[model samples]
Target chain A: MNNLAVDLPGLQLKNPIMPASGCFGFGREYSEFYDLSKLGAIMMKAATGSERFGNATPRVAETASGMLNAIGLQNPGVESIIETEVSYLANYELPIIANIAGSSIEEYEKVAAAFNETDHVHALELNISCPNVKEGGIQFGTDPKMAANVTERVKKASNLPVYVKLSPNVSDIVAMATAVEAAGADGLSMINTLTGMQIHLPSKRPLLANQTGGLSGAAIKPVAIRMIYEVKQQVSIPIIGMGGITTSEDVLEFLLAGASAVAVGTANFQNPFICPELIDALPHTLKKYGFNTVQDAIGKGITV
Target chain B: MKKETMRIKSTKRIALDTVEMVLENNYMSQTAVPGQFLHLLVSGHTLRRPISIADVNKTEHTITILFKMLGSGTHDLASYQVGMTIDALGPSGNGFQLHNDNQSTILLIGGGIGVPPLYYLGKTLAQLDMHIISVLGFQTSKSVFYEEKFRALGETYIVTDDGSYGDQGFVTDVLHSVESFDRYYSCGPVPMLQAVTASLKDKPGYISLEERMGCGVGACFACVIPTDDAGGYKKICKDGPVFDAQEVSL
Candidate 1:
């Protein structure tokens, strides 16, 4: 009860836990397990300009410590979300971050503009990093100018807070992160899925229906943490970190990497009660580790 | 968003990649009819496994599920033995519906592992005073099972592609022999579903489709199929795993 709140720019979330998009589809399922209102916020599945059928079969392929998905952003389109899912999500009474994607910058603006009219939607998390689809994936994320352009467009068009979702498949995230920040992005979330592949060795063909996919799960934790630390140094904006978060211990790691908040992803598939358990375990770990607040633990171990 | 229709009472590994699990919960059992499926939360898998219930004993407080190890999750379930626990969320998707009071001939056709769910459906229909014609197809005789059990339900026929069993071809040939029946029920591969749809275009039939679903509920829009009956796409998880013959576009 002694102040566990984590603020992200203009928005105030009661806690630092939010479900990553695609992992938590509007919190309807999670509601069956626990009171979703207890969490800080929710990231609805990545929305797009039109309804997507997603990739073909075997969209998800498991690796050593993670899984890759080429789901191709399957959704009912943005207008449907505003017309359907948003009302149910708004019931959570916390910030509702809309994770959106598109084939072009104009499409991003269209998706963002739809949410701008809704008072309950706290922010627009532009997913420039998703590796699943054929259009505007790494194309918008890897290049500083492209990243800046999309961020600028959404910021210019959206009345809500804009958080640019960064991709990990880049060589220097610092450049991309810096570019988005300068483009008027309110906050930043990193790093979206890492592009990887799984080979069906017997057939000697790529396992995923789409040859390459975005890798996520416990495997990418280290790489994600490293990205958070590097970006924390270059950008002063709030950082919402997500990649392979499974437990409160992992949450503590993200906090220590200079993330203002953290998101729970792939772990939901492994355990439906992951968030509740982590919520129960988090504060205790913070005090035991000599930190008064979860925020104080942010970037505690990193020198750079 | 399928709820935990039941909870694990006992779980055991009976084979290399096979798990013999029993779940006990009435929310699922009381309304749990045959040919319906249950999605399993396999510990290490990225998602749940949509397994057809092998058998369910409501009075004894048990539902049986057999999971074949295909990947990490099933491999994890395969490692468990007696008294182990797992989560179950289902009795999901529409099961086969038979006219309870009608005295009619019932044709039950299934293929390979698809034969499991029909065992229960055939058993349920046998309760009524009716004639049941069962035709099962498998790749080989070794893979064929429950023939005697299904025979107890009514008349049973077996077919294997290798000719190591009853008929030396697809089971559809034997099923076609019936020519006409009051009703037909089937569950199997897409081609088999397509075949059933094509063959029974002029007859009364019910077909269940199995699609890789996301939420196992109507929400995700992941398991959508063209509806010949409804016009728009219908969600297989909620609207059906079972569909009215004329409703599904092959």
Candidate 2:
């Protein structure tokens, strides 16, 4: 058997197949289907400083190849996560990535600092790329300076590794990657959902109550590959590539395009067996490509 | 959640836009209950579509699902052949709470696609010796379905918007006439659920809600419904697709 272990900046995993935040809750929902300990890591849903109920009803809209969601980062606050969620997750022998986002830098630092106190948490995924909320989410993500500022604050506050999850809505994603890297982000999680909107013809209004949302699914794979390739050239930090990755081949595509790890985001909604299936398929895929280890596939597409 | 390759036993067009499909799955038939749903993976769709289990024949190991061709996913599901196999993940969600009280009368209300699960609920309750009163509403006469099936279990009331068949108005019209309903179970559009909640304020009611879900598990917060408490959200997929009527804000 080949070594599928992925060593990110401050975290190591048995494999590189983990569910993206917002798709996998605190890990209980998917645990019913299969044991979650088989994957690389579990990124808990994005939590805020305080509990958020999120937007009103009609928060999701199905698109041609993907779905649009304006979940508004509804969660049970950081305290609840540490006390209730993160503790329960401790039963499983798996790495946990606490995906944190807030409306302000202080809010971001507050959540990060809280997670930093917990030994159960392996890393903190700074979610500056969420496009659903009215404040602090995508605003910091779209601007390089603001993105760097949030990353800097989080890195200083948290003892755990900080991976800044970048948004795909910006015109120059490479610029965003570079900014966060320069600001001392430990690692990077690329390609958060793109901004999108859908409408119901009968009512002639938006399908989601939030009016616009973040689009994620197989439709965004090509774009994710492009951006990961672009950012891989600009930054030396290990990039965790996501957005529309469904298959082992898709994971290989991201790795070859320069992702150190690949996350199964929207695909988990389609198939609960995805992460395990991909993990099981990776060995055969590596052999098919004449590669011995997962590390060999990284940046295989980039040439001097 | 159990994943099974269930064979389609039969498919019949029961109404204008709705199709009733009975799938043969031994384990699911033995386990499924009312208010629970099945997440079906259509061959080409990226997300699984959550469909309610309309009926279950435990003896035959068959589960019936009623769905309308509202989108490409259901459209693809509508095209399945009898011998064809499809992947199903289910008997999921907290289904209707079936209490042990036997002497009290039970009321069930459903609208459109929401009517399916009520059939299963009524059937389950009937077996327990509970008197089931069902009020099923549709947009018009042509869309009405399962009247005979629901009638077999108990006293069934049918209402339509255009008065083409049964009562001349909404389910609320018939609901006003019926008294002494001890327990209430409802599943339908949000408006229908809201109206039902308003009428049954004095009774213990459980409402099954519908939302566009990403993962039909508690994982994705896509199918959240705001509750009466501030910043408190209940997941329709996990905490409920079935919620206490008084607890939900709608």
lDDT of 1 by residue, A1-304 (tens): 5545787765687878888888777787678778888888888898888777776655666677777777778788898888888988777767899998999999999999988988778898989988878888668988999999999999888888898999998888899999999999889988899989889887899987789988888989999999999989888898999999988888888999999888888877656677778777888878877887877887786794
iRMS of each prediction: 3.7, 1.2
**Residue clash pairs of candidate 2:** B236-B240
Q: What is the TM-score of chain A in candidate 1?
A: 0.97
Quote the lDDT for A143 in model 1: 93
* DockQ versus reference, model 2: 0.78
| Candidate number achieving the greatest DockQ relative to the actual structure | 2
- The local lDDT score (0 to 100) that residue A82 gets in candidate 1 is 83
lDDT of 2 by residue, B1-250 (tens): 6888889999989998899999999989999988899889898887788999989999999999999998878999999989999898888899999999986799999998899999888988988889989999998999999999889988899999899989888888899887678899999988898888897788899999888887887788888777866666688888888888987788
Interface DockQ per candidate:
0.31, 0.78
Q: How well does candidate 2 score on lDDT at residue B191?
A: 89
**Alpha carbon lDDT at B24, candidate 2:** 94
Tens-place lDDT per residue, model 1, B1-250, is 3456455667765433456677777667766788788877666565667788778787976777766666666677666665656576677777888787556888888977677787777777777776788988877766666778888887788888899888888767786677468888887788887877787788888887777655564544456676644335677877888888888676
lDDT measured at residue B247 in model 2 versus the true structure, 0 to 100? 78
